[model samples]
Target chain A: MTYFHSVKLHEDKCKGCTNCIKRCPTEAIRVRGGRAVIDDARCVDCGECIRVCPNRAKSVVTDSRALLKDRKFNACLVAPSFFGQFRSEVSLGRILASIKSLGFSHVLEVSRAADVVASALSKHLLGPNVRYPALSTSCPAVVRLVQVRFPDLIDHFVPFDAPMEIAAYAARQEIKLATGCSDDEIGVFFTTPCPAKVTAVHQPVGQGHSQLTGALSMAEVYADAFKFLPKVTHEEPVYGSARGLAWAVSGGEGTAIAKDDYLAVDGLQHVIALLEEVELGRLRSVKYIEGQACIGGCVGGVLAVGNPFIARLRIARMSQRLVSASLPALDLAPSALTLRQTLLPRPFLQLDANIEVALQKLNELEALVGQLPMLDCGACGAPHCRALAEDIVRGTASSTDCVFVLRKQVSSLAGELMDLAGKLPPAMGRG
Target chain B: MVEQAVLEVAYQVVGGDFSQAGDGASRLKRVLQQIGLAPALSRRIAVAAYEAELNIVIHAYSGVLKAKVSPVKVEVWAEDQGPGIPDVELAMKEGYSTAPDHVRALGFGAGMGLPNMRRNADELEIKTVLGEGTIVYMCFANRA
Candidate 1:
């Protein structure tokens, strides 16, 4: 099967540094032949490599601005994090109006869908026979991480479409009803915060197909939207609730649920640690876990501009100013939330396909690890001694690739050559 | 009958070293994960190993935590040399504890260690002498 990945590597700009390999949460990257190669099955598109690469070799694949001109009736689903990218003084109305001038016929708020999801989740938590410590599935990167690394916790993920998908569905329906455009004529583009959302739109995890036509990066539309800032006379009708607006920042979803026993963790590494604790069964007491791959949540997405802290502050201010309201009436049938396909474990790091073979490889890996210097230096293009051992066992590398081992072997060979020279008969004594 | 392959690893746990109490279990968990064991099974083994290790750190002078891994199951053995429990039955009780007030304050001695081990492990066995030491054996099935 062909897998869709939004993260692309620019080979010419790559320095082949081990920086991204060490930072990648899924360990999906390997430096082979002076280029970083990503194992598509393991990559969750968390954008850590994009953030860590000093040469800017990594970029996300998003729909171009020309895609907007191609569609007859273009509708844009604006993410809540997009509001945080603007200046503090910029009103949400101005931003929405500016987006409208960019040739979008309809500008729908994703936070409205978030409001519906929050309400649905609150009811689900209060309902009977619910699992404790349910995990949030809103973050595509976190969901993919669970599928890849924490397969045991797959059942713990709440079975629901993300707010973006729900908003796309709503936007498409409303655009079709109002403009009388066919599905192909109306293009619903999601203004996404990260590349994972782009991947999600292309190849959704639980659903058969995504409601979104494509994803546009916030960075792509920021300048165009900013240029048309003063074109609006009046503020458009806003439908998002205060709690929904809070979803732009970390801990917002947990706060929206108002659960007493919840953990809100952000940052890819921090989320990994939290998942580890959950996997160890140490977090049995927690009722919910909200994990975001970005540091401060969606506002800290790789495509987002401005400092995350400042963005968070602005989002918080915007949420505080909004009036509390219940979710608007929308078609939220059971069919809308049900998944058509089941998510299976990726098993990206499985040692071998056969258990018996994997066992033998594990033993070999242990022996190789014992012989290694254990310096954890990234000299051999592997992260550490254990990783090098794994690479050797997988036949991608050799034990002699270690600089220390090579040096030691060279010295020993030199000593043996000297000893052999001394042992040779006195033929050289005349010289 | 074919002989099943097994891998064994051991760690030393120092007495009253609260900071390093879970080190053995943590490493064991990582090994289990790397070997591609089911997460639920790995978690069960880790929990049992951690509880046994903590018991040794809090109550015993010193101990060795050993993990034996096979395709079928994972076995954790903790042997400690220190003052042993006089009543194995009482020690197994949920609320019964001989831990000092300071230890309890530090949240080390909740008397739930053995019970938690029993709850997480598929099979648990405890043997103790009044003065010499204690030994805990826990096994978890590596179900796919």
Candidate 2:
């Protein structure tokens, strides 16, 4: 299946360096033909490649900042991490106002929708048939990672639409009501800090369609923010427990929904380790698992211009200042917030469609792997020695692609040539 | 291709190695995933396999865990040379265990091992000889 991936390789900029292949959690990247190739089916679009690509070859597919400068009723749904991009002293109101100056007629908070999601999640925990140690559905990259890698944990996903979806829907409704515009006339865009959100907007996993029109990377918006930030006055809209702003940081969502009994894991590698423990039936006593693909949560998104730690600190300070107010009532029903479609496992890693054939291939792969050097060196254009063996079994690679194997073949051929040098063809009779 | 329908993988489990306790079961899961077994099947068996492995780690001198997989079904057996269960029926109970305090301190002996195995595996069999050893057999039917 051709899975949609917002993260892509810029061929001209690509050095085909093995850096991305090693960092990819799913081993989705391979350096072939002196260029890194991403297997879309295997990619969870976590933007790890973007972070590791020293050549700046990896880039995200998002709307050009110019798109915001249209006459259509463009409403920008602000992520919590966006607040983390600005200095803590820059009040939230001016930030929203500055964004409005950039062409958005209205600004809405995804965090507000996150507040709605948190309450629903809290209620969900108490409900029957709730999978214990529920995995948060908030992070799109983490969700896709589970689909492709940890299929068994599919049931563990909390059956809630992500705050981005909920926020987009709310953005449209409010924009239509306020401006008396038709659905076609209004556009809702999320200022995202990661490429995964762009993919999520384009190809939502849990729902049939997303309400978001498009996504604007925070990095693209940062320049405008910088220019406008200095002139705008502080206007942090202090209303309805801005508690959800904490969602910018790791464990914030879990802490908001469940007072305790939650395990928070951050960064893709750490999240993978945590999932392995869950697979081994560990952490069953924990009520929830808060997983984020980025180290400090959304603030650590690849598209974010600010340092993740600094962004996290800004959010922490801002959240503290927003005195706890009564929460705004949840605007919709369970159907509105819950997943409409069951997530299907992406079985791209399966060796073959036929189990028997797959078994034979696996055995063959094991044997082939034993012959090759176990060095996970990326000289073979694969992440590791075993991965290359799998590729060879899959008919996409050759064993001789390994430099060590090729050298041995070349040396043997040279030896054969040396023996042949003495024995010319009978007809040629050359010394 | 040898047309061999069944494939078997076996691993040895060292006793009281808390750090490496789940290694055998983890490898088994990787094989299952590579073979393209149904996720539901692998998930249940992995859970059961981990419990059985943990039982060996907590109580046995040593053990060998083996999985045999055909197209239609998968079977796993863990043979441990440990002090056998005094009462098989009692040991199968959810809260009954012969584990020492040290094992329980590491959260290895909540007494749910056998019960969890029974719950997860479609079919389960246990053979034990007091002062001798124990052998566990679990079977899971493959589903489309």
Candidate 3:
């Protein structure tokens, strides 16, 4: 089975470098044949490759501005981090007005949907079947990471759709009631900060179909918003409470879920470290965990135009001015908000289908690892020596691919040629 | 009726070292996962092995955590050279521990180690001689 990913590489632009290969959390990318090929099963669409690519070879697949012309009724569901991009002088009303002026009929806030989800979280935590230290399902990359690398922690995910999905769903409803339009006529889209959310718009994990019909990069929308800013005279009122808007930063969701018991961890490395501990059955005391893939939360997404620190500060200041912990009510169906599909484990690490073959491969892999130089240099096109060893046993790579091993073989062959050059068979040999 | 496994691996666990508590179990988990064992089964074995390893780290002078893998089942052994249990029966209870106050402050020494190991593993055995040492052996079937 194959999964959709928003992260992709420009084959023409690739210099066959090892930058993206090393940054992939799942070791999914390999520089093969002068290009980076992504193993679809292992890619979580975290967009780390796009960030590390010195040549800007990696790109994200997002809905273009053409969607505005294509759709009849366009509703743009804005991420909380989108607000952080604007200056302090620009009021929320002007920002909302500017986004609407960019060919959007309705500009909905995902942060408002975040409030709705946050309200239900405490009660959900009290459920009988709820797992302790429940992992957040908000970040699609984190969800995919759990599926690929940490299967045991799948049950820990809080079974709820992301705020984006909920926001899109609510927007579609409101748009339908207001305009008397059919579901297909109303296109609900998200202005996403990360490629993971873009991937979610295509292939969501918790639900069968995402409410969002499309996703646009926050950076793409930022330019258009600024261009339309001056011409937009009417300032429409924006929605979302202080706590809801705070979801743009790390630990924001944790504060909403619990007063002090919840733990919010950001940055993939730190998230992975905490998850390893969680997998070992530690952190059992904590009730909730807010895990985001990007640093400083969505504001740090690679596709965003603003600096993460500045964006984070802007969001903090904006949330403070609102001063309302209480959120405006959104009418939504229970079935529409909850996760409809059960998350499944992605067993990419499994060696083989048959136990005997897998065991043999494991032994062969271990032995092959022992024979190789453990420098972990990416010259072999793999993330490290062990990954290359795994690829060797899997029949995708050869031992001689390692530069050091190749050098040794070339040296030995050169010596043998020299020996042959010096002497021959008895008939050709000199006394 | 345990026969020789096709593969065996060992990891060293230093006594009273909380930093290295889950190291052995973590490595073993990766191996079992690569071998394509069911997630639930691998998790059970990992939990049992983790408890056994943590016990050695918290109580024993020093020990070796070993794993033996066959097609059907996996075997784990923790052999530690330190003060053996005075009462095995009491140790198997849910809330029984002799760990010092310092260890307890680290959120360990909950006295659930032996019980958790027993619950998670398909079979468990303990060999201890008072004032000498203790060896814990646990087995888990690969399939649920």
RMSD of 3: 2.3
Cα-based lDDT for every prediction? 0.83, 0.87, 0.87
Encode model 3's per-residue lDDT on A69-174: one tens digit a residue: 7778999888889999998667777898898888888988888888888877877988889889898888889998999899988998887888888888899889
Candidate 2: residue pairs that collide: A93-A235, A93-A236
| Ranking, TM-score, top scorer first | 3, 2, 1
Model 2, residue A314: displacement in angstroms?
1.1
Candidate 2 residue spans exceeding 4 A from truth: A69-71, A233-240, A323-330, A416-431, B129-132
Give the per-residue lDDT of model 2 (tens digit) for A152-203: 8999999888899988888787778788888888888999999999999989
| Stretches of candidate 3 exceeding 4 Å from the true structure | A323-327, A418-424, A428-431, B1-5
Give the Cα error of residue A63 in candidate 2, in Å.
Answer: 0.7
Instruction: Output the lDDT of residue B122, model 1.
Output: 89
Question: How much is A265 displaced in model 3, in angstroms?
Answer: 0.9
DockQ of all predictions against the true structure, Cα-based: 0.52, 0.70, 0.61
Q: Estimate each model's TM-score.
A: 0.93, 0.94, 0.96
Off by over 4 Å in 1: A323-331, A338-341, A425-431, B1-3, B98-110, B142-144
Clashing pairs in 3: none
What tens digits encode model 3's per-residue C-alpha lDDT throughout B61-126? 999999988788899999999999999999999989998999999999999999999999889999
Ten-residue stretch with the least lDDT total in model 1 chain A = A323-332
**Regarding TM-score, does 1 or 2 come out ahead?**
2
